[model samples]
Target chain A: MVRQKVLLIKVGELKDLFRKLFVVILFLTAFLFIMLSRFDSVAIEALNKVVIKVTGPVMQVVELPARVIHHVWTYFYDISHIYAENQLLRDENKQMMILQNKVRTLEVENQLLSRLLNYVPPAEASFMSAQVVAESGDKFTHLLLIYVGNEAVKKGQIVMGDESVIGRIDTVSPPYAKVILITDINSKIPVVVERTRVRGILSGNNKDLPQLIFMRSTTDVQEGDIVVTSGVGGMFPAGLPIGFIGSINGNRVEVEPMADLSRVEYVRIVDYGLAPDAELSVDFVESEQNAR
Target chain B: MRDNWRENLKLFAVHRIPLIATLMMVFLFFMPINSVQINYFRPVVGIICVYYWSLTRGYIFGFFSAFLVGLIIDIYSSLPVGVNVMIMMLLVWTTDWLRKYFSMSSFGVNWLAFAIICTAFLLLKWAFLSLYFHHLLPLAGSGLGLLSTVMFYPLIAYINALIARKFLPQERIDE
Candidate 1:
């Protein structure tokens, strides 16, 4: 009986030792993967692509219930507010008619002035709309996966919500593209205050408000100033609405993104056709590496 | 022979319940909820599953299952590939070490232990992420995530326990 007990204890010890060793091996393997991903090798990219391609469909299927819930909720919400919305629309339409007449007069005046000055028009941007299929859904990162069906959606295309810029295409695999939101820590865009034309780099800190940095110390900026893309980097077109300055501490200024990023169901992917396909990717990779 | 084969298949399916359930939780974690209010309170469901299964049935829900769960999260999330893998592995290892003390304890005691471990897990994840980004990340979001996970622990634990009681063999569960 004592012999059997001793053998049992020995077997238990061996099992414990094996468990410890396995944990260590897993830890090491995880570390190796982190390093491999940091370097962003071809193998890792290919693996990521394959994983995304396989899981994209699965995510869509899983998202069906949530989609149904959202649609039903929206239907009820719209019904509850329909009367108020109709009244508000009627009031807005009256104002819009007056504004439209003024705009027509301004357009004719601007055309005559432009012909006199020989002014050149900016290149028109092309856009495609896609439904947002998935989101990162974690606090650690902000990203959206949009289903781009058979379209030639390229990297560095700007993704816009109903009224303003939301994010940009970070990676594109056919039938799906990953959008890095303006609120993500990794996002940086060159923007100018509309009233002041004070150019600065808007940096996301994974918060609701992204901070504007790199402006002149003497430059004037105030709360509630509208901010727009400066087209400095050629990635985003100039005069595209981003947000308004939400707050301005002595030097720290934060802009609240105009789009309700959390509620975005569809996005317009705009291509300005400025930079070559490889240039933006190269720049983004280099910047990431340099940040590391 | 066919009867024997069917019995073996049943056993195999029963044994895989914990891992399969945990993978489903991983998928549920990424389900797209459009509400800002709900999105802000999203819990770390994968960690809860790993902790519960490892504490209750480590022999069945082993390291490889934990590793696979983490890999799936890594693939689905925008974060770097191995961060979740490392987090899940550590969770399993930690829970395995403490299983003897808490395995037989009351649900409240188990929950208290998980709350502490989940905090540490979030800190470790934040540190790894901050290190990866070469900067310190804000901790408020993680704090909210922790709160949500801890608040929802009882529901998740109950669901897992039900699965364990229903599908897992009585001897394995008793162990």
Candidate 2:
């Protein structure tokens, strides 16, 4: 009613309303905060509840196409494996002989080993297949959602792609899980060169690869030096594959992710078990990105 | 009596649209969908309907309903709390305010306004969530996202307007 009367009043009287507008905006914001605080998690929780329900069916609908294709593919593979192992090896030997002029995969491994042997840890990481239900590459945080929840996964479980380690499961929602992708700028991992073991902080920088900062000036990092999680920070299991160090510019090292974000499917989550970790001990060595 | 039944049915949908959108979100997030099918369609549809109603009829949505829409998006999308709700509320208020001032007699004005409103809302949501997670995530994929959203806006906006026209009536807001 006050607003109605103010509207009916002359334009000159509205000048007072400017001061009132400021007050109203402040009051509105305050009211919002009050309402939000009162409800606790009502808003986000309410929305997520609905979305999960609605999308539940849509997700089912989406599954049909992939499931059909996968079934067909499995059938084909099953038929091919009908032969015994000796026969299969004999048949493949002929195939390999014909393709003997093919490019050698060992050559690549040898090159990789020479560059990485210095820092390579003997620990082999395991993988568990998971489907992404959510993907947040929102710059502030890069998170991926997996279909496996608490029933299938636990906290501190290491999530990795085919090529390298992603991030640990920070939080798990029932029926759906959130994967904090290593590329999220806030993700901090203790990593060292797979060749030199010159330890540094593997921090996400809103780019595909995290930046390796605070490498010793004498670090043996090169353009393609492999980078792996040092497990120096107890968050990730030590020596899981992280990424390969990209071009090394002085003490600063940029990394290109071994795991491809595009066409990423079937993530492997290692059931690293629930070991409570205190605050990380590795120092956040002040680096160039922070200097900026 | 028949008309009353029809009206009741219509009302059910209006209120349930949020619920329906909420359900759609759950399906998207909770259940496993193959990566090939994931799209922003659900969130886009929910916000568009909410936006349409808020602009044409602000009385029905109220602040709480708008806030609910945001909360829904956050949950289904697994975003930080209060972020999407804040964006939805801002969109509703801005759209409602513009409807009062601009003679949206033409579709072009409505379309342009929708573009601007959606852009602001998306940008704001990204900004806030980014700040909150900035310390934890490396801010990857931020720069390319704006481009995709702009391209997606026209497609989603057209479909949104269509959905709004099909389901929402001009009288629904005034009432």
Candidate 3:
């Protein structure tokens, strides 16, 4: 009986040792993964894609209850404000009618001038709408997983919310893609002040407002000036409205994104085909046109 | 013999309750609530699960289960790969070490212990991320997340305890 007891104790000790060793190994493996991710390896990307493909459907299923609740709450809120909204829209619509006529005249004059100059128009952007299926709602990161549904969305393609630029596609797995929002720390976009044309790099700090950096010392940048994509990098097209400069303290300028990123339910994945290597092949373009 | 086999299968299913619960919490963490306040102050549900399970059902939940929970969170989270994994594993290790005190203590004492441990975990995460990016990240986000998680512990723990009492076998609960 004593011998059996001793053997049991020995076995327990061995098991405890094994558990400790396993924990150490797990810690090391996790650190190794963090290191591998820094290099942005293809293996890690492939692993991410496989995981996302499996979990994307699960996320959609889990999100149904939340979606229903949100819609119900929004319905009541909208009903409460419907009268005021209608009045506002009527005022905006009358102004838009006047602007529409002026814009039409300008469009005809611009077309005639382009014909005389023999100008080749830039490739028109094609877009597909996607519903946000999941969000990284933690304090540390701001990313959204959108259901692409077999539409070809490549990494670095621009994602727009409502009427303005919100983010770019960070990863694309078939049927799902991840958007790194402009408020995420990893986001960086080259932009120019619309009024003075002073260019700067907009950097996200994981805050509501992303800060503009790298502008010249003497650059005249004012609060409330519009910021647009500078097209310095081929990744984004020129003149895409990003946001308005909300504040300036010395060299630090913060931009408040035009899109209410918090309430984004649907987004447009635009293929500007602006990247040097991102141009669609003539056959693909023709097929797209035919399909359209 | 057939009845014995069926009993063993039932036990096996019961044993997985903690893991399944933790996985569900992970899904909840990623749910798109779309409220700015909720988004910024979201609790670290996975950490809470790891801590609670490791403290109460260490033999069943195990380090491997904690690792798996962390891996799932890492896959879903936009933070650098393995950050959550490392944090979860550390939580398991710490909870395992302090399980005796935590198990013997009252709920308030256990919560205090968790609050201290969770604060350290979030700070470590914040420090690691700041180093990774080579910039000082704003700490208010981590501060708020920690506050949310600490405040949320009792509710989640209560739910977990109820699940354990209902579904888990007495032997596992005693362990």
lDDT of 3 by residue, A100-203 (tens): 99999999999999999999988899999998887884677888988898887888899999899999888889898889898899887878898898877778
Give DockQ per model, in order. Answer: 0.67, 0.26, 0.68
Residue range A1-292, candidate 1, lDDT tens digits: 9999999999999988997898789889888889988885555667677877877787677667767887899999999999999999999999999999999999999999999999997777888999988778568888888899989898778899998999888777778888889998878887889998888777889988898877765248878889998877668888999999998878889999999888888899987776724355346435644654
Displacement of the residue A279 alpha carbon in candidate 2, Å? 4.9
Best by DockQ: 3
Which portions of model 2 miss their true places by more than 4 Å? A1-127, A137-140, A149-152, A273-292, B1-10, B18-53, B56-62, B76-79, B118-144, B173-175
TM-score of 1: 0.88
The digit string of per-residue lDDT tens for model 1 on B1-175 reads 9998888888777878998898777676777677787888999889999999999888888788888888878766778888999999889889988988998999999999999999999999999999998999999877888999999999999999999888788785312
Give the worst 10-residue stretch by lDDT in candidate 2 chain B.
B33-42
Q: Across residues B1-175, which tens digit of lDDT does each residue of candidate 3 receive?
A: 9998888888878888999888876786787776777777889888888899889888888778887887777767777888888888888878888987778889999999999999998888888888888898888777888899999999999999999999987674321
> How well is each residue in B94-120 modelled by candidate 2, as lDDT tens digits?
876787765456756765676676667
Which candidate model has the greater lDDT, 1 or 2? 1
Candidate 3, clashing residue pairs? none
TM-score of chain B of each: 0.93, 0.63, 0.92
Give the higher-DockQ candidate: 2 or 3: 3
